[model samples]
Target: MAGLLAAMTVSLTGTRVSAIALPWFVLTTTGSPAQTGVVAFAEMAPYVLVKALAGPLVDRVGPRRISWVGDVVSATAAGTVVLLHALDLLPLGALVTLVAVVGAARGPGDLAKEIMIPEAAERGRVPLERATGLMGVTERLAQTAGPAAGGAMVALLGPLAGLAISVTCFALGSMIVAWALPRGMGHSAPAQEAPEAGQKGQEAGQEGYWRRFGQGFTFLRGEPLLLSVVVMVGITNLLDAAFSQVLVFVWARESGHDAAVVGLNSSVAGATAVGGSLVAAAVAHRMRRRPVFFVAFLLAGPTRFLVLAVDAPVWAMVTVFAVGGFAAGFLNPILGAISYERVPRHLLGRVNALRDSLAWAGIPLGGLVGGAAVVAAGLTPVLLAGGAAYALTTSLTGLRPEWRQLDRPRRTGPSVVPAPRERAGTTDGGRAERSP
Candidate 1:
């Protein structure tokens, strides 16, 4: 368990470094915020589009293999960026294309890490929810340390050096996961045997990797509860993505704060994320996960932008950003636990990626649109509109009948069907077969 956590932290640190270096790379080269936005979009577009397709592949190949492959590819891509910049051969268009390639490879990598968590927990005998909470904490820690580490590394050693550090961490994360995680091919315990391999994965509600990817689309089409959750998150993601980077820079510069504070602003938010994650770690095991989730989703939406619109004093800005960042911490774990509780293991990978792909679809759009909006709308009004949109989306859609399921006790066991409320009606499998 400790090993898993450590591996995740290392992976998260690499993620942190990339966030800092990628933007700096574009900004330094182009001297244009719009171009930076393009870089962000280029990377995320592939990430979202490819992740939608990668989940079934992860499941088919097994997450262990997929994760290792993802790590190796990601490391090479990150390393490529470092080499290009170091050799002074970096071209703007080529750099964006390279980052996008990194983004494409990262789809499976990110999903592989996610898929590994619950499986690792099952193997290690730790509670599934707790393991996911640790993943959240790892992300919070990464955010807390990522920007500062990236900034310092880039400032002192250059962005190429920062990318190199990210590459090393990615490689290390992949290697550790491959070595440490147990195989789930029914060894010590059968636990549950899924569909037979090479059976086309389409029978019994399954499909081949490519076929299963298509099936995920069908599966999610009518599920309003899951769909709404995906939509609400997608909207917020777009909003946040648009404003997240620009807002801080605009806030610091507009307020005439020190050049040093420009970077520190993100750090403050990262710090607060650690606090929020600690809270998530504490309450993550509770049965009633919905109230906190509902509340966090509703609150975190506008609060992020309201603080931005006010353009508070630098200290005040930092405080609010910190609060918002902390609030955001609850999101990933809560959603992950729900996914674990709700989704069947057989289809975990494809569905996980598909759903996440939906939520992330707007991320690149946000990055691109925000950059253009800044020129036309100015940062303040754009921020104001983004905040309002966030609140409206959350309030409008979350109050639905399907969403009620999130509040109910989730179905459990190793089956796809709902758990019987009363013991009398229970059966051996998901179906209502007679107890002979």
Candidate 2:
């Protein structure tokens, strides 16, 4: 468990750092917001598609292997970018291609780490919510540290230096997963289930890849609450991608600030988020999920955009971001717990993959839309529009009947619950339990 978390932290930190370095590099070099958006799209389009496809593979081959291999590929791609640039051979086209490779590899790598979390929690004897909160902390810590370091690197040395650091971090993450984890950990789903179910499980193992993928999709389609959450999160993620990839960078440049200020904004939010994650880790299990989720969304979503849209003072902007970050901290743990509680263990990889892919599907277009909007109407108007949309989406989504199930108690054993339209069964030890 410790090894997994450590590996995740290192990898995520590198990704976050690159997020700063790559966009800044593109914007400065091209001096075109549209090109910046294209770069972002080049990366995320492959990320979403590959991730959606990689779920069955992750389950079939084992997450540990997929994780390490993906990291290695990502490291190579990042290193290529640095090497080519230093050699004066890197073009915008090449840079976009390399980042696309990184994104493609990153999809499975991140999903593998996420798929391992429930097992890690079980091994550590931690409750699901706390474990997810800890995972959130790990992410928040990366967000806090990565941007700080990237900003410094970009300011002092160059953006290339930051990219170089990303290469090193990816390599280290690969090594950690390859060598640090215990043998037999993160085994294939079939191997893990075979002993318990004997021949029946082995038969299921023989199912084709597309069949397995279809099952995950079918299962996800049947869950109304999960579907609603996915849709809402998808919209928010799109806005966030725009905010981070284009709007904020443009805001900083237009406001006569540097990359350091950008880093500072993210780092402050991340720092406070760590505190929020810690608190959630300690007590979220005892809290009502619906209110907390909605409240957190309210604080986290619209405020950052509105603050920037108004061209607030740096101090004021930072303060709002800090508050928003803290609120955002409580979100993932609750969502993760709910999803983990609902999905059966054997289906974790595919189900989570589909869920995450759907939620992230809009991200590839966020930068494109933001860049075009900025070109058409400028930053402030776009920010205001995004903020209003965020506020409305989050606020109105809570009224749905399905969201009320957010507070459902965690089951003691595996959730063998069938989809809504499936046949309901008695509460026997091994039957298909009904969805709410």
Clashes of each: 4, 0
lDDT of each: 0.67, 0.81
Q: lDDT of model 1 at residue 223?
A: 52
In Å, residue 425's CA in model 1 sits off its true spot by 20
Work out the TM-score per prediction: 0.84, 0.87
- Cα error of candidate 2 at position 212, Å: 0.8
Candidate 1 per-residue C-alpha lDDT over 319-379 given as tens digits, one digit per residue, 9 for 90 to 100: 6666766776676776777676665565567677878877776666775688788789887
Residues 201-281 of candidate 2: C-alpha lDDT, one tens digit per residue = 776677789988987888777777777878888888888878987999999999888877877788788899899889999
Among all candidates shown, the one with the greatest lDDT: 2
lDDT of 2 at 367: 78
